[model samples]
Target: MSREKLLEVQDLKQHFRTGKHSVVKAVDGITFDIYKGETFGLVGESGCGKSTTGRSIIRLYNATDGDVKFRGVSVHGKKSKDDLRIFNQKMQMIFQDPYASLNPRMTVMDIVAEGLDINNLAKTPKERQARVHELLETVGLSKEHANRYPHEFSGGQRQRIGIARALAVDPEFIIADEPISALDVSIQAQVVNLLKDLQDKHGYTYLFIAHDLSMVKYISDRIGVMYFGKMVEIAESDELYKNPLHPYTKSLLSAIPLPDPDYERTRRRVEYDPERDNDKSEEPVFREVKEGHWVLCTSKEFEQYKEDLVE
Candidate 1:
């Protein structure tokens, strides 16, 4: 709810009930602030609830508990239709599976123009067509491709169409939920670069969710690490990669493959042993290890980290 913050998520929780009354904690008490014009990356394993967190922020799924604030306004408490419409125009989402996100039957133009139609943003058919073409070109697609269906495009192209559709509404915030994961590895970079370019040009803020560490490092201004639906660590990109504090974070970073075979061979992998869970029971609570670097873990780890800092 700060003036400088574009989005503030406070202790967000999302739980799904199963048949036996068991609950899957998809997102559990995660909190973060995203400033305007910066990419805040959420990185974790596939089921760590990164995507669900993104969806919850955009109101795609209602949060079981907590608050999501946009520009000092609470999205969860908004009751006015005009306010909701303003929020919709300001926030947008790009889905993981491009093929499924886009309507297979709709023409590219219609797909891109759908937001404009729904929002009544354009006054005439010609204006809508122009807006669609502009969005297509912004995502590196041609205006001629507007008449084609989504199936006619490749995975990367389809993803571009998805980006265009999101862009059509002229949004200030975007939740890119694994935007390049489904595409070929070679094509992944292209999509990422395109997104970066668009962000740079428009000064857009993004909550980029991905399991790929290297890609997240490439696009994110800061990175947050999640484990079992909980955020364990968060820091600037370089700081997190170079000096991860949490045991889970260390383990996750250790798994990233190095390009040099010699380096890869010599690098020690951090093992996550359930037997070693005793570390969580001992002294410092979740405390700041350094400026802007936060770690949520056992008191012992915090004390040890603090000791290291003092030393």
Candidate 2:
């Protein structure tokens, strides 16, 4: 593992056994590195294992195989209780669904203070209460709101509470799994901005998983595209948008709506014809298209990519 890397995920695979014979490969052999203080975006269609990857990285689900290293320590495999607890404190996850993630029975104070209490981060009740108030304020909520229940708040407020809960432990890395998806469109920007501001202020690393390409492009330093439980391409955000190489990536990029109606109507959509290309074969192959840019697919495409590079 590199010293600069905050979270190093190597060949991570998560499989679900579906009875006596069948299995669902939710995440298969995907590898990526998240450096400290950088937001690494994982974008894909729903049911493409974006959330699964996020969950697996945070140890919400034990990986079937592969290694997830936080700092220099391996988080997976057998470990002592103390070591695991330390790793848990260093990394935390913000779930996708704001409505279901929070406990309706618990007040906002209890919800945000739960992690701090579990980790023994505070010495006394007064100290914990103060910490909870500070966390709520950090996420743009007033201290008075802490007495209210989750049902009293709006979707965006609930999500902010979730963010505050994740931040309570002072985690170095966070898996933000579609943090703004459940909120109203008008409120989404506010949540995104809050996250960005938090990152800037606290120097937190994030694996921001979302299906929205534009949002991912806006928040991410680099992006990785996954399809059918496989990582098809990964590159710097600007380079990926400007020069997407994989057929799947091109198709995904084509789906993003343009601002002008006339240009939107005039622009041709890049259609991925599986029959015409036969690029979905079981055999996996990845080639380097440019510095720090990788594409996984067929040999012919790799050859064509090479020719294009030369030209």
Per-candidate TM equals 0.94, 0.94
Poorest lDDT segment (10 consecutive residues) of candidate 1: 277-286
C-alpha lDDT of residue 12 in model 2: 91
Task: Flag regions of model 2 displaced more than 4 Å.
Answer: 1-3, 278-282, 307-311
List ranges where model 1 is wrong by over 4 Å: 1-3, 274-278, 282-285, 307-311
Tell how far residue 93 is off in model 1, in angstroms. 0.3
Could you give candidate 2's per-residue lDDT for residues 34-121 as a string of tens digits? 9999999999989999999988888889999998988878887888888888888889999888979999999999999998888899
lDDT for model 1, on a 0 to 1 scale?
A: 0.89
RMSD vs true structure, all candidates: 2.2, 2.1
